[model samples]
Target: MITGSDFYHVMTAMVPLYVAMFLAYGSVKWWKIFTPDQCSGINRFVALFAVPLLSFHFISTNDPYAMNFHFIAADTLQKIIILVALAFWSNLTRRGSLDWTITLFSLSTLPNTLVMGIPLLKGMYGDASGTLMVQIVVLQCIIWYTLMLFMFEYRGAKLLISENRGGDMVMNNGHEGGGAGEKAAAAADGKAKIMPPTSVMTRLILIMVWRKLIRNPNTYSSLIGLIWSLVSFRWHVTMPAIIAKSISILSDAGLGMAMFSLGLFMALQPRIIACGKSTAAFAMGVRFFVGPAVMAAASIVVGLRGTLLHIAIVQAALPQGIVPFVFAKEYNVHPDILSTGVIFGMLIALPFTLVYYILLGL
Candidate 1:
């Protein structure tokens, strides 16, 4: 069990990160050091360099065998559950359309493993926990992201099919100007030719998904890191010191810059409550409650105990990721859910984790 002193150390260790975020919020909201749009550059700096390198470092340095399958399974299963639930809810409620479902599914499924997971788990558990967290991040980058890309391609393919059908219908309508039997023949032809068959659409979507999966930065970085780890396992191969140090410099800047940018985003984002209070509440509840609950139960089933158990639980319950928010924004899927889910999720991350920590007997 975690002692009172251990808990105190954990809480205190978290203080600096929170303080940085608060200062960022104050800088933008009060002083206007930079607009939220301007902070996009900082986010780019973190994503293109910092986070990838951070992931690369832990992944490459750790024993490839250090990563385990049960943890990945539990985590992935939780994400799949969220996706299915959101899809059902989107159609059922009609409050959040299918577009909103993708964003909310992203928010609930992918936790902020890069920025928040690294520091918090390290503080609560130990140095080893950071490595474990990165392993989880590797899983998130590879599996969860590819699934998201599939969702986007699915939506796009549906739209294309719908448009083709509509165009065919218009053609059928114009054919009515001809002889009566001609119109009937035209309608029959339109119905036959308009929508691409399901198999055809499925093939198109799969090809797009494959192209995107290959091109994703996270995919490359994670695969490379895993390869490096596996290679090093047999023969002790290492990169040149100069190059490793250069990557380290960029990786070092990731966490602080990420926290500051998060704060900057909060300040830049307009504070109007556009999304329903209930939607926001449901997102938070799924993220903070259901996620960890599922992970915790899975951890037990997988026979993870003590620190391993706590780390998995905490990682599962970490705040929503900036990466998923970026995806939502870029795709124009559900900006409201991405924006609100992230900001509000950050607001409660600490208290929510603390509650989980106590209940877990950590």
Candidate 2:
């Protein structure tokens, strides 16, 4: 039987591997193993193809019938509540707003289940936990992704609308252009020409959101795989074994490469550390510590057991997924903060996440 301490060791073992791999990538980059653009291309390939394929593959393998729906429901609800509470708490810090609160909370609460959680669970709990991990990932895909995109897009819209309104007010007067003497006279009157309807701004926002979301072919490929899975579909075409081999390399090697790319990006930016500290701390605290605590407490209160506890542990302990960082990058919302949060969450989650599961004795 795997003891609680053994579980801790599993987590500890994995972190060093991840850290070592990331270091290797860093070393290679420092040595000019790849140009900056090359490194970026690798990161993009991982994010767009490898990661999503892994998600689809892991999720598609499990029999949906094996999932303990009762346990899944209970654990999922607990996770969401804890997440929302953390969002509220972070808002209290005043470092982030309700919008920022939502983004941080969502990102911190949802982990990279395909990359991290499934493997960790399988290692700790064997095949029994794999199916549960799959179900948890499924829930993440449906609920977490929806919430993430909606909140991010909404926040972007809010900012854009406010700026546009202010600009319109300025341009409405003579601020756009005028003769020097007339402009000075008009400025005294504080009057300007009424600007025409640039009011289709909302449509532009929608287009921007859709364009970004669909720009990555990999995201849609995952969607395709998901549909295939749901419809009980399989392709028997004997493609070269090279395809699976390539995917394997992409999924395993790609993660560290991705992380290193993120780190280098952070290293390039000034004020990354200063801007991200508060948000990073907040996200790490909730994700590795407080979030799990909330789930554990809720589990005990509701008398959850076995597979339920295992599922909860997996879900609670997941580090933030790359998708959140992707959005942060797209929206130009403090990449340093986002990168810091990812690094911090992954690092701290190593030991504490194991402890969370061990304490549960699941």
Candidate 3:
């Protein structure tokens, strides 16, 4: 069991991180040092450079084969279950758009597995405890992130194509912008019904989504990490020392940069909260309670034992991911709702995780 000193030690470690967030808030709200655009740029830097390098360094340095497939399967299954349930809920209420659905789903499914997970796990179970969390990060970056990106882009393409088709129909319907004589002539032509270019639209939408996915830096990072892991395992080729050091320097700053950038985002966010009270509460509940509970159950079924199981469950209770919220803002999908949800979720999950560790007697 953890002594009183251990309890204080864990809580103290969290203080600095939370303080960094408030520092960003103060920088924006009081000092006016950073404009909203500059905050967004900081977030971009973290996602494109810092976070990717962090992922690459962790993944490339580890043995991919040592990963437990059962744990991976359990994690994926939990996410899929949540996604399907949310899809049904959205359909039933008619209140869920694709934008909010993906955001809410991600908020429910993806945890704060990077900045928070690494230090928190290390504190509780020693440095080696974070290995499992790194695998989770890799899976999230590649598999989960890719699926969501494709869906959002693909759905957006369909909507744009549909809107364009509607405009074409209006044009062909003799709504002449020219003089009355042109309008009369156009109407008198008795134009045949123009069928929608359905097949062409399908093909075009696919292409558009493909292009977006390929362009995503996170996609490349995950792929490179995965390939590096495989190659390193099979051929015993380590990254050159110079290259590793370069990545290490940037990646080591990722956690601090991410926290400060989130504060900047919070200050610059819109005045109104788009997420409803009930929705925000539901997200927090799932994040702090339901998600961990489900993951715990899955881990048990798959016989995940000891520190591995503990880390998996605790990681589930981490707040929503910063990378996902960044993506939401970038896509103009559901930033307003996501912003509210993430803020509240983080506040609740952080303290709750502390208590959970004590109960576990770690």
Candidate 4:
């Protein structure tokens, strides 16, 4: 029973909804209504708890009985193709290594499945759609996050080395130690100092992935939650119904507070917007339009319907995943360009994604 008008309505409503959340957070932040410690507390809560709980809840509800592994394969392949396509195009355009890698990273990564995808799906198809979003996210977590960790760590180390070398050269040679001529020489050497070798990056990425996978609180929380959900762990210790309602209310409010803190972090560093309009435009196009279009056609051709359709759209529509920015920030890739790509993807996908659901008659 869905129609184009429904699509437009849902899209319009949801965009403002998310924007309003951001605006509320921004206004409060600008007014200094919350202390830094309060904001940090929210971040910790969301990063460790609220988001993971949401993920677990979503996955638990979706039976995945009719799920198509082909859709998962298709989603993975499409992302890899887009990654290679952007990498090649960037190289052809001579967009430098850092920029090229970032272009690829932006095209392939997606936002947190829990925070962004589930809410957007729920708006389009209610609670059922939100559950499907979780399944798609689990597939993505397997491939995207694992690879992203590697990329972020390797690139970050290279940047650190480059910056340190540049600083030491300037300090040791600049002033009287070597005078102006020595400074010029050091500057030339600094210019020639390239990023570390690719194998080094590869190794660092593996190391980072291993470390995070084995010990990260976020990973552990998600894993435990999934196990609990799948195995049906619940306490018979009953509290008052009002208390349950109160807890849910508090958690929802906490989630909003956490998101606001993240928004503040994003807003304070406006330099992420400087990655050039073209990069942002290109990245957004790849993530939202090309990626989803490819997914839609592929899903139909491969006979993915119903729950699989639900799952596929969530993956197809999700903005650039947070893992990329996580890796980029941690490993120091083209953080500005990567961050800009991610932000652009999230903002644009917010409004246009409803059309995908309408196509599903949801």
For residues 113-137, could you state the per-residue lDDT of candidate 1 as single tens digits?
8778877877787888887777777
Task: Rank by TM-score, highest first.
Answer: 1, 3, 2, 4
Q: If the candidates were sorted by their lDDT against the true structure, best first, what order would they fall in? A: 1, 3, 2, 4
- lDDT for model 2 comes to 0.59
RMSD of 1: 6.2
Put down candidate 4 lDDT per residue, 95-163, tens digits, no spaces. Answer: 547545664655644644566666666666666556556666776555566666655555555565667
The C-alpha stretches of model 3 lying farther than 4 A from their native spots are 88-100, 161-202, 270-276
Q: Identify the candidate with maximal lDDT.
A: 1
The TM-score between candidate 2 and the true structure equals 0.72
Tens digit per residue, CA lDDT, model 2, 237-283: 33256865665666665445555655554434443344456666766
Error of 2 at 67 (Å): 3.0
Q: What would you estimate as the lDDT of candidate 4?
A: 0.58
The local distance difference test score of each candidate is 0.74, 0.59, 0.72, 0.58
What TM-score does each of the candidates earn? 0.83, 0.72, 0.82, 0.68
In angstroms, the error of model 2 at 286 is 1.8
Q: After superposition, which runs of candidate 4 have C-alpha atoms over 4 Å from their true positions?
A: 1-20, 28-30, 35-38, 60-70, 83-99, 109-112, 154-205, 233-255, 305-315, 355-362
> Clashing residue pairs, candidate 3?
none
User: What is the clash tally of candidate 1?
Assistant: 1
Which stretches of candidate 1 lie above 4 Å from their native place? Answer: 80-101, 165-193, 210-216, 272-274
